[model samples]
Target: MSTELTRNFSIIAHIDHGKTTLSDRLLEFTSTISDRQKQDQLLDAMDLEREKGITIKSHPVAMKYKAKDGKTYNLNLLDTPGHVDFSYEVARSLAACEGAILMIDAAQGVEAQTMANLHLALDQNLLIIPVLNKIDLPAADVDKCKQQLEDILAIPAEDAIPASAKNGIGIEDILEAVVARVPAPVENPDKLLRATVFDSIYDAFRGVVSYVRVFSGSIRKGQRIKLFATGKTYEVKECGVFTPKMTKRDELVAGDVGYFIANMKTADEAKIGDTVTDSTHPCPEALPGYKEIQPMVFSGIYPVDSSDYEALKMAMGKLQINDAAFTFSSESSTALGFGFRCGFLGLLHMEIIQERLRREFNMDVISTYPSVIYQVTKTNGEEEIVDNPTMLPEQQVIQEIREPMVRIFIMIPGDYIGDIMALVMEKRGEVTHTETIDDMRIMLTAELPLAEILIDFNDRMKSMTRGYGSMDYEHCGYRPAKMVKMDIMIASEPVEAFSTIVHRDKAEGYGRALAIRLKDVIPQQLFVVAIQACIGGKIIASERISAMRKNVTAKCYGGDISRKRKLLEKQKKGKEKMKAFGKVNIPQDAFIKVLKSGD
Candidate 1:
């Protein structure tokens, strides 16, 4: 019989490197999901994640594996988020396990993000099992990839497991490596229950569902546990594991990953990195972890149709239930009608959430450009949250206006390095270091302001490099930088909702492009509309829409006064159905044209 030892580990890979598909095969092998029902990527339970082909959050699952030694071991698998925007979730997931199965796409070799993740995993001191995935492809270069992995990550190359996660080859070897190298959890039979809250999501009925890693002791249903950080205690109403699927376990002991329900509702109660302890004898302190995340990108999300304001608010609330990173507050606007201001982890996260809101919730939204939070010191030496572009204080009156900056890493073909460098320069990015990864690929390190890449930066990068360049960035604190105000003018007056803080160097290009784009989208209306870019009180540029002179005509009474009134009634109804921008009402395509032109 195989030994009764257990292993708790997680599979972490860059986006789309077969992590989910491999997890599915493991689930099928253990019969968690039947072959007939196994579509693919079983642990990607979220409909949005599965449909988007990117894991926005990490999910924990449990499975029983039968080894060749004829022994059964419980495997707790955590599938982590792959996007850079979700790296905080990834770190929490890694901390939950004693080992990590790092899957590298054999054909593509190691990527910039793959290296970043590897460094984070090393810092955790988890046993690393390097697996070369997608070996079934003809272009797979196992030997070369092995050499690079060893050279780059300083790990053993010969030990790298080559397997097709799609076809289940070498999966047994992967399990064997885990059982051999990964240490089993140390059980504390006498100690009170303690678990780490790796991540949490909100459920309508359950409040917050905390996914925890049981560290030292056993926990049972109906037991009272205290969340150390928040000093909140609640009775466990439910407990279960991802047997590839969620399987209810009456009691989960040390060395297992599971979900528990604490009627201690509210998403803020069970914060990630907090510890779970017995309520009767609480732990002295919470677990040591990274500091709480601070939002670096700010944007305004407005409802396109004012009539759907209530629906948009409800939809945003529902979306935030699962996405704790989203910080929002409702505000009213004459221009936007009504909407909420949103803070995001970064630009990508902002875009992803916006797209999700539109596609899944069917809510049409107008998003302002992503701007970084400005550190404004008042005359009394106090601080405030200033996100609006027009709200900036005068340079002389300001004590200091600090901007957030980050360390950016990019991997691109050598031939496209110059073009990428030029783009970065235009964004006020400064190169810190450059290294050659291979004859074809080069790695660039730069310190860039977060606001620089908030707009069509991603699209522009892809277009310039022909999709051969990719980048990842982490906030590196703040710096003193030149700042300019971007004003969105409606008619001839500046709209407070449209102002943003941008680096002085980039203001002209971005402002001009936006003005041009708005000109096309703002539509011809009953009155003329003008789009202007301003720095402080001065308008730098403007784009105007000619006045619409003939959209309506008056009708006289046709013998009967009521008959003429009926004709006017029809015209009023038609005008009422059109979209209103400022004082002008426009047709449907007007708004659509601005979005499509992307000027």
Candidate 2:
């Protein structure tokens, strides 16, 4: 097909706003899939995504839609994830398209992520097609949704299309609007090949298969391609487009979105956002690549059994190929043994990885508490980035500690604004701005320490607002605070696995709570064990596990009282010796009991 008859666009939205559902409807409407082949969320390939009702990866498909003007257009549709953690996926998809369908729930109105995605689409200068999905429900107020669109996003209310992806309403109107509004690609095909790699996957038998959006020239089988990022060259063995599946295409011209298999032995070479050009006549400049992912959350992942360490290593390697944001390195702890310190974009990303490890690779694993990177400035004018609490230096060496801060936007029902504001203050967050969306809803912008909201802050907000709250955030910067590293010690020895960095003001109460939870799980030995939560040399909180008594005087009831006293005294001396020299064995179950995340 010619470039003039081709349209490239993506469906972007907030979580569960029906991006995937809309994709399914479009694919079916265009006959991209047969009646028997059609199913819900057909674009969501992962089992975890289907089970969770979330889109973890962006899916690309090609369709042939005959418009009302009686012209068949080749449409490249990209369906992007909506959750904040997967915003990176949306950005990647947007880079390859000329337009986006901004999806919003009709009953819910504009949400935090909806605004976040809208800003991303505007940044790319793409044409936006506002869509109010799920309009069939009784609660969906078309007038209110359209008004919110004009008020918050500044998009004209008349342009917003009201449709239900579930019942297939306005499917033809959406397709017709897409063909009329979205512009065709204009890159020259005669120029040297410069294909931008939006995504790629590791195929066991086929090696690395790259998904590319051709910018100039064309790519085909038997062509030699040069990867701009790694400066590696390979001969393309096959090329194909996704009719939702890999169907062979003789050649992919400029403006085409397709996958090509090269002899890329390792996943490291075919990086996403890489520019591919002809090896014999390479493009002078590589296309601008996506910014590198800076992990917002960090945690330690260990195999349940020590012998599965190598297997876990292989599993992580496989996962890293598909997800560029996830990162890990070799680490060890006294309680958990050998493990990898993994970095994730957010809590959801972390959970998805753990789920994938269990379901896909069958790698049973345990993870320690999640943490964020901290900036530590020393007294001698040196600075260090610490993710793990055990890497924190001694109290005497640190000058000031800075923690990551995020600017969070929370939208909730207006009636609970006071209660939600109180919860924010409880988490050491300050409300910066508040705007009423309408008579019923309000949006609150706040600055919060990343660590403070890492665990249960979202849960609390939802409960307080009666499940009418939604939140999205972006990292603003770091701010200096009175931060300290607290350690859990058993019998005077600190366990590296249970160490955490916390605010100084909350250390007392937080430490006491942790110590109490630990006391319940750690088994009692022959000698009394002291569990202490310590900040440097001073203990903030402490708990003790009583020793199990043997009752040595049970067999000497008729003996003299001195005999019983001597036995008791001997036992006490033995217990004292044990307490002084005994090495405490923290059970695996104890680590699981204490370290499992609240999510």
Please name the candidate that would achieve the greatest lDDT relative to the true structure: 2
Tell me the TM-score of each prediction against the true structure.
Answer: 0.87, 0.98
CA lDDT of each prediction against the hidden true structure: 0.76, 0.91
lDDT of 2 by residue, 4-75 (tens): 999999998888898888999999999999999998989999999999999998889999999989999999
Residues 352-419 of candidate 1 have per-residue lDDT tens digits of 78888888789988876567787777676877657766567765666767788889898888898888
Could you tell me which residue pairs clash in candidate 1?
Answer: 2-70, 2-71, 62-242, 389-499, 389-500
**Lowest lDDT 10-residue stretch of candidate 1:** 549-558
Clashes of 1: 5
lDDT of 2: 0.91
RMSD in order of candidates: 6.1, 1.2
Residue 331, model 1, lDDT: 77
